[model samples]
Target: MSSIRSPFGQDVEKQGIKLPKKWNDTNSKIPTDRTMAVGGGVAVGGGGVAVSGDSSEFPRKRRQRYVEKDGKCNVHHGNVRETYRYLTDIFTTLVDLKWRFNLLVFTLVYTTTWIFFGLIWWLIAYIRGDLEHTDDGEWTPCVANLNGFVSAFLFSIETETTIGYGYRVITEKCPEGIVLLLVQAILGSIVNAFMVGCMFVKISQPKKRAETLMFSQNAVISMRDNKLCLMFRVGDLRSSHIVEASIRAKLIRSKQTKEGEFIPLNQTDINVGFDTGDDRLFLVSPLIICHEFNESSPFWDISQEQLAREQFEIVVILEGMVEATGMTCQARSSYLDSEVLWGERFTPVLSLEEGFYEVDYDTFHQTYPTPTPTCSAHELAELAKKGEEIPLPPLTPPPIQNPNQNLDGERGRGEWDEEGEVESVSNGDVKKMDVQH
Candidate 1:
């Protein structure tokens, strides 16, 4: 049986357990697909949490997406027959529709209302005997030159649009027609205001503004301020800035509690300097946002090796007001555990140029290898508590000096004199010793 290092600081056997494919060796070639089906059990705390189904019965456990990479919710309502709910808030419903659908609805609304009024105009001319007396110039018809449905339809268009072609002017012969004209004019204005507002709101949506606010392709894990931090870069492509921008992150992962309660797609908040107010960013240039792996961090237990066996997603959210429009905008992106690079740091992409600082977007996602500890933050904290000292280089010894040399590296002036042993260094007087054999 193969052994797996459990996160609980123990080795557990992989017997009768089916691990997710991405949880294998880090150096192994992993599949690009983040979807996985783990059918068996995970060894936790020396116990196997087995599933109740066999391979044929269960087949595979599909992982459902809570939030897509683009920050859209992956939920859909089914079997709800409350059609009136959408009708109650019809304006919002129309605004949320796709461009093609909205355009079709916009066209149909005007066409249908125009036809309904055109049918009324046709019926009025027919009942008033105006259609048969079009050639009788003495007969003042309710609508001049009106004879058929086609003319009525054209008249409806001309009236609603205020074209006033003057050929189909309404006469005072039919006062009932006068009342219909006033009603149609008021109804036409209402429809115009409603439909045009929907189209205008749809066209000016702030969703597209988020496209200019870009997030880095990948997130990184490296040493920062003597702590392990998860980092990602964000920037704005437009010259106009995002006012009062702030960023937040969430860790999405499945968890099994101590009581064996399984919680799928659980989300935990990842602090990106909220306490220190670093979450509020001045996004003039591309800035690397960092989340320190402190005691309260979700990634505190994730080491470089454990990272390879971890399957979790980090969703980053950036919210700010558009400086040009004064409207709030939000941008989002996610990084799977596979996208995180350990023992690496993002390269410098900002440089000083003439008159201003220049930001290079080309190298925004580029990173280079750096020395980082492979241990988890918890393990490092433990080591720190124990006061463990890192090994240092060996010390060197001083050079040896000859006794015959003075401090200046010159020969001593106290040499044996011819008369007696006269020792004198520098200008000191020599004391002669009588040599008695």
Candidate 2:
């Protein structure tokens, strides 16, 4: 029998019949590998996609950072109509400012108040003709050393700071000068309260405590208790423990609604076992926080291959009260798609010692390869369902005969033979044993 071949390009070539000129020219440089161009990345045949790192092929675009790796908000507010809002909450604004700005404001507030009051004293001295009669011993100036703005300024500092050097004194002859001194004293107290309070609050900020609370540099995905889990390690460097600590995660990605509305930087919650109270951590040592892949998870349908192609970030937040100060503190870290490792698990950083367990921070962020399925959790569940449907062989039953039953089915009766030998029954045969002397 002769085999018939389809009229494909290869078959036509073998038959010495070439395709048209235009068709051959267009298909000459076709790639053998199955690859699809999606956006700026190439999807491989293994369901993985790779964004080209080469600048010529694809120039890298900077992703908008919602939260920086150091847990600072990268958002900047501008064009605000309520410009006076910051001043209305001036105390809070000053407290929130950086150390340099706070110190600058503190210095300026005291200096400006002092200079303004000094000008008033100098004006009073000039209006009373005290500057003109400097040599007259009879002329009692409002301020004893009423010569120029310098003397007035020196008196202002002494009055506000309560440092009475006894050289410069306010005279009782000028009742206006006495009232002015009273006013300066009250204003100086107010200024001290505002400036000193801002500095105190800024110095005692809990933000610095978060520095000792660390997160792993990279996140990893692997099987945990027969389920795929996304995990990251968190540990505290200081000896003091955090009280009532809990961890939370968010998936930040751009998404389009079913109504075709584009929402940029949409946040979705990733459960770290909050329902089962697993999110509350003891945190005596380094703990691996796991987010199990389930239906509610955004990564439920994401496979190891698709994860590399995803353009998303996972922001982790850890909140707790400082054991020493009893103040709440929050620490945050993020993992980009490039920072996530598939089919990998964190190396053990804790070990048993003589009296207590020891944590090795050197291996805190370390991870190693692990055996894991590349398929999505949804696909794995479907495969598991199909496996359950496949019928298994039935089990065989054993005979229900009692061990003490005799060959005649009599109970509690001994069997003996007349030849002085013991007889025992087998499947369907009897065996004789010789009597021992």
- RMSD per model, one decimal: 18.4, 20.9
The collision pairs in model 1 are none
State in Å the error of residue 205, model 1.
1.3
Looking at model 1, report the run of 10 residues with the lowest lDDT sum: 390-399
What TM-score, computed on C-alpha atoms, does each candidate reach? 0.74, 0.74
Instruction: Compare the candidates by lDDT and give the number of the best one.
Output: 2
Q: lDDT of each structure? A: 0.73, 0.73
Global CA lDDT of candidate 2, please? 0.73
Q: Candidate 1, residues 1-437: lDDT per residue as tens digits? A: 45423222223232333335343566663333333534333222222234443435544333333455556655456456888999999999999999999999999989998899899999999998888898998998889988899999999998888999899989887898899899889999999999999988888778989988888766888777788899998999999999999999999887779998777667899999899999999999888899999989998999887886566778899999989788889998877665687865666667778999888887676654445688898887888789985222221211334333322222122234444332332112334433332
Give me candidate 1's TM-score against the actual structure: 0.74
